[model samples]
Target chain A: MKAVERVDQFYLLKQLPKATALLCKEGNLLDASCSWLEIFGLPPINKKQKTQIFSLLPEVEDLIEKLQEAKSFNLRHEISLNNETRHLKSYFAPWFDEKENVIGTIVQTDDITSEVEKEEELNWLKNIMETKMEVSKTGWWEYEIDTEKLTWCKETKRIHQVPDCYEPTVIEAIEFYKSGYSQNKVSMLFHKAITDYQSYDTKVMIVTFNGEERWVRITGKPFIKEGKVAKIFGTIKDIHNQVIAEHRVKEHQQLLTTLVDSLPLNVYVKDLESRKVLVNKGECSYLHKKPEELIGKTDFDLYDREIAQISREEDIQVMKHLTPIIGKETVSCLNGKTTHFLTSKIPYFDLEGKVCGVIGMGLDITSMKKKQEELCDLIKITSMQNQKLISFAHIVSHNLRSHSANFSMLLGFLNSEKDQEERKRIIKMLTQASDNLLETLGNLNQVLDINTQESETKKTLNLKKSITGVLHNLSAFLENNDTQIINNVADDMVVKCVPTYLDSIILNLVSNAVKYKSPGRPPIITINAIKSDKGVLLSISDNGLGMDLDRYGDKIFGMYKTFHNREDAKGFGLYLIKNQIEAMGGSITVQSEVDKGTTFNVYFNEES
Target chain B: MCILMKKVSCIFIVDDDPITVFGIKKMLKSVADCKDIQIFQNGKEAYDALIERQNLGKPIPEVIFLDINMPIMDGWDFLDEMIELNITEHVVINMITSSIDPLDYKKWADFKDRCPYILNFKNKPIFKIEPNDLGCITAAS
Candidate 1:
């Protein structure tokens, strides 16, 4: 090996800033720069002594062997010089002789400590950015207006379902959006942002390369240079999942609204303040207002003060108790008509179990209430008729039994009689008893006829004329009894009544007055008629022996209730008259006093 | 069909129906042996006569056949008046009426507690003198 030219190597090594060194083929250090000595903390080498490179830096032992086995260039490694660690780039090249034969090798070393650390930090930062973009489903893009070049990041390519090396044009990028609204929206925004130097953030629907539709949010900003729009850059985010969830929520809300609006009942939701939040069609029509107009208004705004106060109190009770309140309410309409409703109010709760409002539901029950009242009235009438039937039976039995008993007694007398005259008298009594039995049966049959037959057919008859006809019919009896008949009814007064019932009623009244006359005073009968709203009031009053009403008020109209001792008093006259009046949809009431007079007020219903 | 019982003096028949009174008088003639027989149209007449006889210090009727359902005063009213008058005489009163009404029977039963003079309650149609009925009145006297 030729002698190494240390002077020339020292000059060349001094030109470089890093630590530089040269070693021989035997791996001994031939020359090193002053900076290298300073780095390794080594003293200057003497001319006669040899120091091996591996001994000076033990970290380079494997590197020296690699250089010896094969000629390597620029192989890098790290070594500790002195007590500090430094990273170095090494080169091992052989020097050639004139015959082009292998001579000694040149080992060049460079300290690259700062450069290595900087490159490692750059690589770490790049790794973090890539991971963040993948996790967030985000991508970025840039467009150069002059060159019309579109550049996309690695993440942007993945979002479009494109190959990593694929280059996209501005038109190709716009085509990725769904064809109609989404596509047009993006185009318009893009042009506007460029010309106006505006920035936009929007969500758009895009069809990927694989023909799958996806939702993306694009945020774009345009660069203005020299007072003119130049370039555009933006980010695209995949927001498919978020958009779908929002759409489902909207659809569910619409379904609930439709269900509430179509119910037949009056359905409403009110807030804690008693303000209406929601109302159905029934409530809207009932209030004579539209849903939009009624919303946010309280009952006070739609109803009178009295009704509104009641409604508000009910709502407050529901929320305060957190329970349902059910009751009946009467609502009067604007036309002065009243309606009844069966209403229920329930406390509405939020997701957190707080009572936030009340829900009111009501069903109109006015017609049902009316029907119930009518049913009660029918029951009362039925019970009254039943009582009358029981009384009639008892009267018939008593009258018949009395007559039969008298007949039996007379027959016994006749059988035991020894004298012919006595036997003849007994026979006459038996005949009289049988006649009384027949008469009682006839009266009972007349009473039964009034109960069974309908007397609905009515004819207009003059009141005075009808009374006169009845008086004429009973003229013989009236004259014999010396009864005075005074008809006070108006000549022109007309009444709606059945012809037979009217005649029977007047005749019975007149005969009763004559039959029950006081012994000292002659019977004076006064028949009067007056027109009233309840049809016509016909009063038949007599100055004859009037009964003591207090003693027999309840039984005055009962069958066989005789107040006087007259032999002809069958006691069926007043009973028959009352029944006949009632059968023709009329009522009869009597006012009487002992030895004074009796007045019968018959109220006939007007024919409709 | 005469009832051979002890003789009863001052027998009274009070009724509203003349036929009922005739029937009772005829039946009593066969059933009882009485010295004096008096007839009254209603309870009021009988009651007034009894009160008059008591006031005059005379003997009242020993037996009375009273009928119900009279015009001026019924059998119940006479009995009530008899109790108020405080008649000490031992009169045997029998209520005879054609009425089959159970109410009359119930009212008589209730009155039995107030007036012990009521001897028996008999239904009408006393066709002949029943020895058994006359015996009851005679035994009570």
Candidate 2:
């Protein structure tokens, strides 16, 4: 019986697949396999007493009882050993001896942990693949170029709205693309892939299994084997949303292009390196060239060296920063005229907010700049005249006050005096002072009248007629001075000037000639007006006692300036004559020599 | 009944015009009570005489007639120097001129703050005095 029990233990241990075992008798383990020793947390290839195994694995008694209950009984059971976390599947059977007597129970266990882990991994992989197909909404296809065999993933079949078992050949795949350019394109692409191993990426419309049209983007790469086409694999993507978005963007760009080109101000955009990428019609016109000529060129190509250098520096500044710069500068056009322009340059940026290039716009402001300067000059002149007028007012007031006060005081003294002789003396002196004051006031009034008179209401008047009238008015003076008149004036030459001013100007010139007649010789006056396209050129030359040009050239027409002594020469006439001519937009000039003849030349505007 | 009073002692006329000085002296003799009167034709001549009299221990003129509107020097210029020189402490100065300018009137009215030095203003040699006049004998012996 003891030998049979030992044989039973060895048989159980040999039958187990890498399992531990123990031999037991009378509710105690007698011997065990080396694996059994290790299973019980003992050293390798070492055995322990059955009593120790029975104490550690309390369920061993139950397995023994079940083993004794039936002949050749086979049962599988789980046993816990020493509270460890490993599960053991044990096969139990009754042991037999050499005499074929039932002696003890035998148990065997095999670990199945790795097989379970592989099954879990396969399930996880299937879940991940299914989730990917659902999320990406993508499908893939492979084509065997030599065999013309095509395979589609399940998701690909679903995307085509077809059944799971559907199979399509290369010809069918090409036919699946709609007829027309799509079919042609696919045929060429597939032929290229087979012969030349060229890949293709394109969008095409297709009819699905449900008879519905849909847009798809197909990308392909060919597999080459031994320098021969083997197979082609690619992806089919549903990019309908992206295609629509791109179409809208193209439409918006077309509208914006039209609007920018129509603007009067020149507008242009540069690329990533400040090279001209876009130019509008107005911008091209400034260069005297077409838009195509300006493209791919920078400012240095279009502008002169100095201007281009300045503009390029500004463009570089904008490209290096995110701020906008605006400046006004003059640009020399092809016509050689400098045009003032207000320029604005701003940085262009990509969506990531990095500096890309610059966009510049220029508004032509040449006329506006000229007008502003003219207005400033007019303001300066007006203010200067205003200062002179204020001073004139003060002087007039002071002089007039002094004279009036003296007159009033003289009147008071005359009234208070009773002595006949003294009153007579005072009256005579007052009369002389009043006469001088009257003369001064009269001169002032004459200048003021000429300055205030408006010449805008002038009409076309015959210059010869006005000059003749002046000669007639001054006939007595000329006769008294024994002045000889030499008239070679144009007969009907007309000019645009106030008639009264023309008469006054001629009268003053003739009278001055007569008044300054030489003492030794009679004055000889020559009057002539030459008619030309510009205007009538009137000259009045006098062989009189003329003054020195060096001394009187600047002050020849100044008010209260008298060169010769004549009782009626108040010196206000020439000044008034000059003022009148200027008010009518005419010019007067004089040439003189001391003790020689003087000549007055006048230019009058001719009406168109 | 009024007690008799002595006439004004010396009358001095300071003016640039000799003719105006002669006219004033003749008119003053005809119009006002006068005794011995002396006339100086300019501020410098008049200022020197007053200072010399002070040195000689003689009484200064009782009446001095000053004129503005003169060449080289005038009445107001004389008053400025006279105050500095202290030439006359007891004499009365009367400004007389042909200048009827209101600005001149206002200027002289303000200038009268150096009173007794510039006592009053009259129109030239007419010698008309108002009720406000602080009358001192203009010419006396």
Between which residue pairs do clashes occur in model 2? A29-A50, B8-B139, B8-B140, B9-B140
Which lDDT value does model 1 have at A282?
84
> Pick by TM-score: which candidate is best?
1
Model 1 agreement with the true structure over B66-113: per-residue lDDT tens digits: 887765567887888888988777777788877788899999988888
Give fnat, all candidates. 0.53, 0.00
TM-score of chain A of each: 0.59, 0.51
Candidate 2 residue-wise lDDT, B1-141, digit = tens: 322333566767786544456456644653446676777655666777878887898777767778764323457767777777665456667787655567778877887775546478776434334222225433424
- Tens-digit lDDT track of model 2 for A1-608: 66666566576654454654444444345445656555555543223422533455555566545645744443333444566444445555556679966666555555444554577799999788767866887778998866768998787787678899999877777777788987898788878877787899989876788886777888788988898878899777676678788889998998999889998888999976668988998888788888788889977787787878788888887787767888756465555778888889999888998877888889989889899999998897688558546645754664465456556656766777898998887787677658867977986786677667653467888777777788888888788888889889767777788778788888889888877878879999999888777787889999888887775576577554455544566557887777677656677999988778899998886652
TM-score of 1: 0.65
> Per-residue alpha-carbon lDDT of model 1 for A1-608, expressed as tens digits?
12356555467765557566666667777677777766666776556788776775565547655656646566667667566777777667775579966555666667789999889889988888778888898999999899999999988888889899999999999999999999999999999988888899999999998998999999899998998778899999989888998888878887877877777678899999999998998888877789999899998887788888988998988899887887656564544667778898999999999999999987777788889888888887788788777766667777777788898888878877899988888887777777778888888888888888774478898888998888888889999998888888988999888889899998888888888888889899888888887789999898878887876787778776666766777667888989988877789999998889898899987763
| Over 4 Å off, model 1 | A1-265, A269-277, A284-324, A329-334, A346-358, A411-420, A474-494, A517-535, B10-18, B34-59, B70-74, B97-102, B124-141
TM-score of model number 2: 0.46
Give every prediction's interface RMSD. Answer: 2.0, 8.4
